[model samples]
Target chain A: MDKIEEKELWPEEKSLMKAEISRRKFITSATLAALGLAMTPYATLAAAPSNKPVNFASFVEINTTINGQNMKMKLDPRTSLLDLLREQLGLTGSKKGCNQGACGACTVHMGKDRINSCLTLAAQIDGKEVTTIEGIGSETEFHPIQVAFMEHDGYQCGYCTPGQIMSAIKVLEEDHAGSDAEIREWMSGNICRCGAYKGIVEAVKSVRDETYDKKLIKRTQQKVS
Target chain B: MNPFQYSKAKSADAAINGYMEHDNTAYLAGGTNLVDRIRRDVTHPDYLIDVSELPFSKIEKIEGGLRLGAMASNSDTADDENVKNDYPIVSEAILLGATDQLRNKATNGGNLMQRTRCSYYMSPHFACNKREPGSGCDAIDGHNRILSVLGTSEKCIASYPSDMCTALAALDAVVQIQTPNGGKRSLPLVDFRRLPGDSPEIDTNLKEGELITSIDLPESSKAFAKASHYLKVRDRHSYAFALVSVAAALVMENNMIKDARMALGSVAAKPWRDQEAEAMFIGKKPSRELFEKIAEKTMEGAKGYGENDFKIELGKRAIVKAFMKVAGLS
Candidate 1:
């Protein structure tokens, strides 16, 4: 990736340079833990500018993956991941009820976690993976959570159902999801205007219970093995 | 929203150069915030420089703290075991707001660049100064329930609507940016982003063509790490911007707070980091008396009109509650 520079910065702008230096120190350890590999500075990022000889300006490009597909495109420096998927790439499984990201209709998976696709840009997911409802298996062979949503009758209007299921699936991997209140608290981004919330709750509840059961089964199987 | 020309930047310098060369351009990251604003017609950029691929996508350790690459997805950042274990407040802030889908798509840089989620500004039919300079604001009397009560001008009252940013403010984090010259610098989180003040259109200190490379935390063993909590109060159970949200970190020694950090979200034009509250809580146990005193002091200069008076009460409650949760008081 390319690196850029600025015109001689104000005394204040120069002060901010240390923020990256400070961050790079800790971020390397965390990154190694998560990816189980070392991150080379400027190896992944663009090279730093030679010296200060430019003016201040504000636009840049982002490169990322979308819906389980690797993609590179020119975004309106402001194009959102949700908009690009739905509007540009035509991956419309993610809805756009509230463009401000309050509504979770546009939920999708980024690696192991779920996020509101509406608030993200298409250019930011470079080298990562995304899983939308369309990308999350199929109607015939649904993922465990998707099947659970079906068995639990998880939608009325069904607008928010995709996001709900996506969030629930991600919740299966988290430690903070303990009780019903916890589940509700964590799943707060999705809004079901038809008030299908009870069904949504039940779907998550069923998956969570099954997850616990699976954990127990794994423990037992390990002992048997 | 409006059809525009675009380009993909393979390197960070390319992205910066693309922006430097263009005038009406905006750098796009997660697009979770930027795309919506454009679709709503609030922003109309002529060109977009895509910089999501400049390799600043990982979260890692630094000499002092954690460095969250500018392009790091919120979803990835939220679920990082290190973030969960160390900067739980940051994860909690991300967890408490926005759905899983948006988190995956939104970037830390985008979250920082996000604008106010003002209802009036969102509407193409309404007039807004933030959207169009001197266009006049319809929110003063018209659907003013969710407008900011602090750091707002007569022209714009929109609050910067990022739950994660509020937590960032309290954490006293830093933002790493790459200049068009390729020189790197990091700014204090407080000064990195700006208040609406009079120039409501400008949100950050980022100059055109500059790329936000990452966000970093100070030796974040406590302030952002283990001793943190995020509390949000809203009208509905889900899918609503916080009516009032509190992000706090408190370290207790012998039942008294040794150090405290507090920031309020959704009430001000920018994330409101209450240094006053922090100074007040040091050496004080998080008792009811102390919490009430801190809230009163922070709320001293808070100004609100119309339906937002409830926010003051809610803000107080959220702070107290967040402190208690982090301090394990209740």
Candidate 2:
């Protein structure tokens, strides 16, 4: 969980910083100033003397609920939410296909809405709740969307399934899955290179129809209390 | 991505102060485009001032139209009852671009401030004046199928890449800004983005250390609210950048155009709006012949490089199609 300590840096990170400072050709006093800034826990890396003094934090501590588990950790400001979930928390259900937002392979639910975990920084989720693919269903029992994907043969390579399923759940919840065309348009963000569009559309369509039917079927006549 | 300092600001003034105090700083909002560019090494910031939590996330109904908070997510802004009902073009444009997850994370202000998606500008290997001031522009001679056709200079030809801003231009939206000296100012969204002239590095008129607080949609545009259409033509039907797009709105009265607003996207340095040309549609009736003439007038001086010459014709067709849809004609 500890990537780099705040006050006492890991030996490797310390060596890296020393190498960086030496490469920058700073004067001995400036090197001391840089090391001094590093030693001061959570201090931003000091730049050249001419630059303005930066007061930003290098280490950000966040308290967030990830996959239904509360976690409090100090993370590097550069760590993304996807990296935090996959590397630090050991939840790799969210795949990082394109680290950028272009690929929906890193899709996850942040609270009630879906977001690209790769684009979200760990610090941004300080007080928020995040749900990865692992958080969606049990081992013995899969979520309805997962079941629908299996039944409908929604995936080919299975690499993009987690992201597709995550996106599909929101598409259905948003009532955007009224038809196959609508599903394709709404799920456009998540690209499946396997060209499994036919199955993905069918899986979402089947679930959407079932969800609508359940609203009427599951409605039990309320008896007077 | 480069190692950088990051901090969350609690207020607008604090955010501005944080930005002003740093030698090289960027205000992090949605992080949808900023984070991606950081990963691509196209943009490098020494310090990131997180203004996402600055309490500017409201989408309030103003006296005439709506006051969209700068921090409001694009998804929330697009799905708002008022935005969907009164500003349907904005909603449609936002939905047409980006995916559901991106829409949820990209903020309204960040959408306005997003950099160009030009291949030359995005990669460090290529020469882009926008990325580096003195560096020559590779897109001028390279594969510029997606580059701008109008308002382009020899220095840069990158096209502005926001469908939402294209719609806002038609609506005549005003961007409210918080200056670094604790003052506030507002400019029309049309004037907010600058054409890539001698200095392509400067994207907007926003000065250094200033923050955008909100965007105002005026009441005057409400007339076009119902009869507006956003037509985007891209390589893919969804989740792709527009090759040529148009935002057209008409306040029609008894089969006659009372007033009209039109703006073209992905064809110019900024959203290409010719108010002088649009004025021609004010007194005319809806006709295919009239729409054709207006489309031609819109693309009068649009010049294209090798791979993007098709954009001129595509832009004209998109403009006419958007007009036809808004006019409720075939």
- Among these predictions, the greatest DockQ belongs to 2
lDDT of model 1 at position B238: 56
iRMSD per prediction, in order: 16.1, 12.0
The window of 10 residues in a row where model 1 chain B has the poorest summed lDDT is: B119-128
Q: What DockQ, on C-alphas, does every prediction get?
A: 0.17, 0.23
Candidate 1, superposed: residue stretches over 4 Å from native: A1-150, A157-190, A203-225, B220-226
Please write out the lDDT profile of model 2 over residues B1-330, one tens digit for every residue.
677788999889888998998988999999999998887777889889999988999999878779999999999999999888888999999999889899999999999899998876776644679999987776776568889999999899999979999999989999999998889999999999999889999999999998999999987888887799999999987889999889999998888899999988888778878988899898789988899998888889888898899999888888888888888886
Q: What local lDDT does model 1 show for residue B203?
A: 77
lDDT of 2 at A102: 75
* lDDT tens digits, residue span A148-218, model 2: 78777889999889999999999999899988889998898898999888989988987877642233322
Worst 10 residues of 2 chain A by lDDT: A39-48
C-alpha local distance difference test of each model = 0.71, 0.84
- The iRMS of model 2 comes to 12.0
lDDT by residue for model 1 (A92-156), tens = 87888866677778878776777666666554555667777877754334566666666667787
